[model samples]
Target chain A: MLTFVVFSVRRAWQGFWRNSLMSLAATATMILMLLLLAGFWIIQTGLNAGLQFIEQKVEVVADLNDNAPADQLLQVETTLRGMPQVASVTFVSKDQALQDFRARLKARGQEDLTGYLDTNPLPNTLEIKLKNPQDYGNVVDYLDGQPTVVSQVTPIQNLVNQVVTVTNFLRTVGVVVLILVGLTVLFIIVNTIRLAVFARAEEIEIMRLVGASDAFIRWPFIFEGAMVGLFGALITLVVLAVVATPLQEFMYGFFRVLPLQFGTLVVRDLTLLVVGAGVGLGVLGSYVSVRSYLIR
Target chain B: MAPGSSTGLLRHPTLAGDRPPETTSERLVLALRDVAKTYPNGRAALRDVNLTVPEGDFVFLVGPSGAGKTTLIKLLIRDELATAGQVLLDGQDLGRLPRRQVPRVRRKVGIVFQDYKLLPRKSVWENVAFALEVTGTPGRRIGPAVDRVLRLVGLAAQARQLPTQLSGGEQQRTAIARALVHDPRLIIADEPTGNLDPLISWEIIQLLLRINEMGTTVLMATHNAEVVTALRKRVVGLEDGRVVRDEVGGAYHRED
Candidate 1:
């Protein structure tokens, strides 16, 4: 059995190397397919990360009445804590709010917020963080349902809605592109291996006549395809690590002015791609082509 | 039992007519009964052809182009099924055998073709060993088996040479050697000497003869009349997909 395996592998290697052009073409297709798949995966991962960051910061603000009693404010905090959707609620007093404003102003070298308002009139605020970004509306509804707090304003509501809509849209686009890229990769490798098989149809026929079992004949070509795919995936990973992340980060910085690391994202994604879809797809493509020929 | 074993030989003289047949009993090695075929394009490739080949018999089936010689050979090997009638080997119909069992049938009947389809990339020794290796021959057994067959075909010296590097005659002999590696009971050669010179053809025919003498049944389909007449073996002639003549110890057909 060991000898048979050795012979089977040796024959496949001999056939692959004997026709260098076909072998090279198969390798090239596998690499191209893997690169595209990994690139798509990396883009999807980075976009998902950015969207998750936005989702994490999405929350509701509660505006307290100017003359509301301190004990009543404590009642509202307790009310928020009882709701399942409300994860936590923090009270920001009027004085504390003013202090926060002054700290922001100090960063701009203009820490003089007390001189503008004669009565020191910033409202007491309630900052409500929810268990889910999508449940922000539920928190707003629960708080707004109260008779006394009906007039309270949430300035972050519009921004939250816009972020949710845009993230959902971008996710849909990402899924569509992922599917398209996957199909394109599959087509490229399948046709490439099929062409390789066609070129060696006579060899296949001779092998069939010689009583080489279907598996014995098939495994080597499949192995070759896997090798080609592995090589292609490696090339794509290198290119992704060196190119896509930096480009994505540059684009993100242009859009949001946030500090983004293109290199780190690419490195992380490339590792996943080279190991997962790279090896998987290489074997898959070869198996499909080799089985098709074996039937004939 | 071994040929003429003590179990049979001891009791045979007393039994007389009731004794079992000899080791050389004339059992049918291959039988094609009323086998006919028509291509999808409506061309009748073979029609109502009947042939019976006995064990240890070297029978040549001769015909001109389009006379269905190759088609008949294909039917025996189960490469092509007949459109009408049936083919049998040892009373087992070729049509009834599933493809999985076809390899076993092929193992019993070896074929050597005219074009010499040895793998160009493989060495001559690997080419012959390819047959035994497919039949699940162990690694140690393959080397000796391949060497023995290569010696029989006079190719032991060039065993390490690639088919592309060898002469046409040598390549054909390597193919023959590969065919014979498994010691099949029936050897079918379809125009085995078609591409060779007279001297080379004579050498191959002599090898075939020697193998036949060693008790293998040989069915050679050929176009060479001179070789056929010289051999003076049993001949079955085909004309337009039908059998025209069957002669024992016969020569080739003549215009006169």
Candidate 2:
């Protein structure tokens, strides 16, 4: 068994360099396909991050009555914070709301109509953030039940529903596109490796005639396929690194307002994804291609 | 030159003097009983073909092209299944051998092709050793086995040359060396001298005769009437997929 493995590895190394043209062609195709897959995967990751940011923006604002007691408001805020669906609940006093209104008016160059009023009629509120956007309705209903402390819950249910619908559609489309691209890469890579195997049909035939076990003939090609995959992945990573350096500023500028996660986390996932797919597909492709020759 | 004058051909270390090679006197090297083969396209390649080659016998298979010569060889190598009967190699039924056991059984029979199926990229030594290498023979064992066979076939000096660098006879000799590396009980030569000049063809025929004299059974399929007639060996003639004649000390054609 040890001899077999050593022989297979040595043969694989020789076979790869012996047919350098075909091997190089296979590696080039593998690199191109991996790059395309990695590009799509990075885009998909960014899409997910942006959608998560959008979902977190779905908050429930509950306005308290002007005459409500401070203790009742505090109790309501504590209860909202304790709910499993609520990520956090912050108390906003009437003074802060009025101040925010004045700031927005000043920024927009509108007249300070709010300051002209003799008394501040703005209501104090509790802004509730949910762990998941889909739990918006449950939190709104819970806040509405607190009629004594909560005067009226802002009916942003329609806005939340619209946002959820758009975000869900985009997420589904993103996943579907990723799957389609994955299948395309699989077919193209497998076929390209098949062509490489086909070029050596005579060698395989001679091996078979010489009473070579299927494993003896098969494992060498599998190792060769793996070599192609390894080389392709390394080349892809180098190209991605070179390109990422120049594209960093452009990507940061475009995603500044979107709050997408783009750092070491994304880079790590992309590396694993590209390398894993490159090697896995290479082995699978060779296995499938060489199967027909060995069956008889 | 007459094959008998080939002085050193049969005198090598791995040749005639080497313990009279392990042939079981009572056992048959190959046995076919009522074997019939019809391809998927409904062409009947062989019908009611029954042949038995006992230990240490040399047989000649002669026929026109498409007379089931190739199909017969294919069945012997287990490359194709007999659509009807059994092909027994060394008392084991080929039809019933498990898929994984096919290679083991193939190693018992060494085969040579007319085209000399040598890898162009590999040297003569590598080509011969390839048979043993792919069979998972130990590296230490492969080197001597290959060396012995190359010396037996008189190609040891050209062992480093590639197939393209050698003549047709030299390439065929390399192939025969590869076939012999496994020390197979049966050596099947399928028109092995088809591409050679008559003089070179005689050289290959003499080499096969020498191997046969050393206790290996040889089944040669050929269209060479002159060599076949001159040898007067056991002849099995196939016509329209049927064995029309089987005779010992027979000429290539009927005496009439």
Candidate 3:
């Protein structure tokens, strides 16, 4: 068995270099397909992360009456924090709200006219972050039920519903597009390897006539296909590595608000996807291509 | 049992008539009984053919073009199945052998084509070693076996040369060396001398005859009438998908 394996590997190596054009062509196709898959995969990852950042923005805000007592405010804060669905609760004072409004206006290049007001018109509010954005029902109702201390709670159910629907639809579409691209890559790579195998039909016929067992004839081609995959994957990783810094800079520039942590995750996922798909597809293409000639 | 063993030699002569009839399988190297082959398109390539070549026999298959010679070779190699009847090699039926066992059966019979089928990129040494290499022969055994066969075919000096560098006869000898490396019981030559001159053809025929003398059965399909008539060996003739004649010590054509 060891001898067989050694023979197969040696022959596979020889076959690869002897038919350099065909082997190179197969490797080229493999690299192209992997890049296409990785491209879509990167886009899908970005889309998902962007949608998550949007969903995280959903929260319920309860406006406190200006003259509400300190003890009542402490009780409300404690109650909101104790709730299972609420991730956190932040109290924004009237002064802080006014300050935030001015900062936004200045950031947008509009003049802050807040100095004309006799007093701060913004309300002190408790911002409630839910563990799940979809689970805002209980928290919103509880805040709305606090009539004495709370003037009004934002009715954000309609807004949350609309955002969720659109984001979910977009995610589904992105996944469908990725899957379609993946299938196209499979067909192209498999066909390319098939052409390589077809070019050596005479060699296979000679092997068969000489009483070479199926394993003997088959394993060498399989190993050669794997070599193509390995070479393609190595080259693709090199290219990806070279372009990575620039690509990251571009991503940050476009999606500037997205966290750097999400970018790292995308990089990790892309690496795995490219390597896995490249090697897996190469082996599969050769198996399918060589099978037609093996069947008696 | 060693290949080409004659079980007939063990028979007791005193009670031969009463010992019951001998079945054909025990003595035959290859047997085809009532065999017929028809393609999917309904073209009949062979019809009601019956042939038996016993152990250590040398037979020539002769006929004009499209006389089912190629199809018959295909059937023997299990490249095509006979639509009816059996093709038995060494007592095992070729058609009934499972797909996985086909290669094992093929190793028992060495085949040579008219074109030589040499890999242009491989050296003559590599060409002959390729057969053993692909068959998973052990590393230690391949070198000696290949060298031995190369010597037998008188191409040991040209072993490292590529096929393009060799003469037509030298290339054919390389193919024959490849065929013999397996030490097969039967050698099937499909017009092996079709591309050679008379002198070179005689050289190949002499090599085959030498191999046959060493107890390997030879079934040569050829169009060389002079060699066939001069040799006066077993000849089986086919015409229009049927066996027109079968005779031992026969000429290429029938005697008056």
- Candidate 1 lDDT, A186-233, residue by residue in tens: 666666667667767776666666555666667767766666667667
lDDT tens per residue, model 2, A1-296: 88899988887787778778877777887787788777666655665565556556536788899888779878888887888898888888889999988996686467888756889898888777778755677778887888888988864555656656765776677667656755555565456556656767787788788799989988987887787788889999999998885565565456553544448888898898888888887787677766755565
TM-score of 3: 0.80
The better candidate by TM-score, 1 or 3, is 3
lDDT of 3 by residue, A41-62 (tens): 6655665666667567647888
lDDT of 1 by residue, B1-256 (tens): 3434433211112121232233345687887767788877888988777677778889888999889898888888777888988788866798998867777777777788999888787899988887777666788898988999999989999999999999888998898888888788889999999999999898889999999998889999999899999877878888888777666556777322
Ranking by lDDT: 3, 2, 1
Docking quality tier of model 2? medium
The candidate with the higher lDDT, 1 or 2, is 2
**Model 2 Cα shift for residue A173 (angstroms):** 3.5
- Tell me the deviation in Å of residue A46 in model 3: 5.8
- Cα lDDT for residue A203, model 2? 78
Clash count, predicted structure 3: 0
lDDT of 1: 0.74
- In model 1, residue pairs whose N, Cα or C atoms come closer than 3 Å (at least 3 residues apart or on different chains), thus clashing, are A31-A232
Flag regions of model 2 displaced more than 4 Å: A2-29, A43-58, A62-89, A92-125, A129-167, A243-268, A292-296, B1-25
Highest TM-score: which candidate?
Answer: 3
DockQ of 2: 0.62
| Per-residue lDDT of candidate 3, residues B1-256 (tens digit) | 2322342112111121122223555588888877899999999999888787888889999999999999999999999999998899988999899988988889999999899999999999999998988888888999999999999999999999999999999999999999999999899999999999999999999999999999999999999999999998878888878887766666787663
